[model samples]
Each structure stands twice: as structure tokens, then as C-alpha cells.
Target: MSATSDAYRIEPVTPAVKDYLRLRQQAGLSPFSEEAATRGLAGSIFGVSLMQGAEIVGMGRIIGDGGCFYQVTDIAVLPEHQGRGLGKRIMSALADYMQAHLPATAYVSLIADVPANRLYQQFGFVETAPRSLGMAMKIGAPESL
Candidate 1:
């Protein structure tokens, strides 16, 4: 489909508890269902998904402590469906969710991956300077049922 003629249906994925787990793995991101099942988790997560008919094409989420900080996370579009600005749409949806619920003074952040970092930059995200840096510690690999 040509850029001028293609129109995609963008919405948060629903009734997709399983497909959600599969797509996240496809994007090389880990699933958090076991953690999510716990009744009172410490963080808040707002998820948005992009779909085409019955298939989930992309997804993103915001996770944080609900008060002082938030992070834009898990943004992904399948390999065959990328280059069409779907990731941007997902981010915008998550951004809108954030704007509606986040405190004015709350800190919003994310860790960008490779070329995708360029996309986040368009939304006024700047690299934190010498005082701060992105870091992480991986746990056990994802276990499937």
C-alpha cells in the first residue's frame, strides 16, 4: 500500500491477554504477567496497543509510581509493520494518557533502543546529563506455561 492511500485502525488492544504476551516477546521485551497478577503492585502501568483487524500490530505502555515519576515503555511495532509511524501513534496515545493523569511536576522518562531513540526525541525528550544515566539489571529469562 502506498503512503498516501493506506489508513490503519489504531486503538488499544483489548481481549488480548495472550497475544499481548506473544507480541512483547517478539519485540524482545519481557512479559510481566506474574508480577501484574499480584494485587498491589508498586508501579502503575498504562498500556496502549495498535491493531489491524484481529491482529495486534504494535503496543506501548507507561509505568511508574503514580506520583513523582513515570516512564514511557514497551513501545514496539512488528518488523513487517514498521516504517509507517505506528510507533509514533502508540507513543502519542501513551503520552495523552500521561498528560491526562500525571501530576504537573512529575518526572517522565524512558530508555530508548537504537534508532527508535530518534522517535522519542521528537517529543522533547532530552538525554539527562552527567548527573544521571540509564541503567538496568536483568533477572531470569521469561518462563512460559
Candidate 2:
């Protein structure tokens, strides 16, 4: 498919639990339990779903305190739908939301996977290495302790 394909459109809506799990798995991201996903989604500040007809082929979300902090997370696209600029479409919608709703000093950040870091850069995200680093630990996982 071409970058400008009209076959897909980005919608400003949170993806349903099923679509959220499916897309994350299909896109090779970490798995989250249904219960965890459901609880997490309810806290979204803003989200976008890339749709084709009635199917969600991609999705992204922003979550955090309304005025002081925000995180860009869950950016995923179905493996079959990758490489068609759909990710860009999702990010564009998200960026627009952040620009419009987030306070001036609100800090926004994302822990991007290697190659996808390039994509995040296009939306004004910079690597905060040298001085600070991105880190994470899955709850209940041994490594987290």
C-alpha cells in the first residue's frame, strides 16, 4: 500500500480491549492481561485508532495527569499494516492532541524501541540518555525487584 492510501483513516478514539490486546501482540509488543488493559485504558487522556472500514489496524494513546505530565504510549500497528505511513498518521493525530491540550510546561515522553525511535523523533521526541535514561520494570516480574 502507498503512504497516502485512502484505505485507512485515523480516528480519535480509544481502541476496545480486544483490539488493544490484539494489536499489541500482533505488533510484537509486550503482552498485558485483559484486566490490566481494561484498567489502563480507562485512564487514557487521549487516544487514536487507525481504522480501515470498521477494523482497528493501529492505535496510540497518551496517559498521565491532565495538566502536569503526559506519556505517549501503546503506539502499535498490525504487522500486516506496517510500512504504509499508518504509524505516522497515528502519531500526527496524537501530536495534534498534545499540542492542543497539554499545558506549556507539561512534560511528554516515550520509551521508543530502536528503529521506532526514528519515528518518534519526527514528532519532536528526543533521546534523554547521557544525563537521564529510560527504564522500566514489569510488576510481579522477578527483574522488577
Question: 119-145, model 2: which lDDT tens digit per residue?
Answer: 999999999989899878788895733
- Best-fitting candidate, measured by lDDT? 2
The alpha-carbon deviation from the true structure for residue 12 of candidate 1, after best TM-score superposition, in angstroms, is 3.8
Candidate 2 minimal-lDDT segment of 10 residues: 1-10
Tell me the tens digit of each residue's lDDT in model 1 across 50-122. 8776677777767778799888876877777778888888878877777788899989999988888899988
Q: Which regions of candidate 1 are displaced past 4 Å?
A: 1-6, 13-15, 30-44, 141-145
Evaluated at residue 144, the lDDT of candidate 2 is 38
Clashing residue pairs found in predicted model 1: none
lDDT of 2 at 123: 92
Q: What alpha-carbon RMSD in Å does predicted model 1 have with respect to the real structure?
A: 4.3
User: After superposing candidate 2, which stretches have Cα over 4 Å from the reference?
Assistant: 1-4, 142-145
What are the per-model numbers of colliding residue pairs?
A: 0, 0
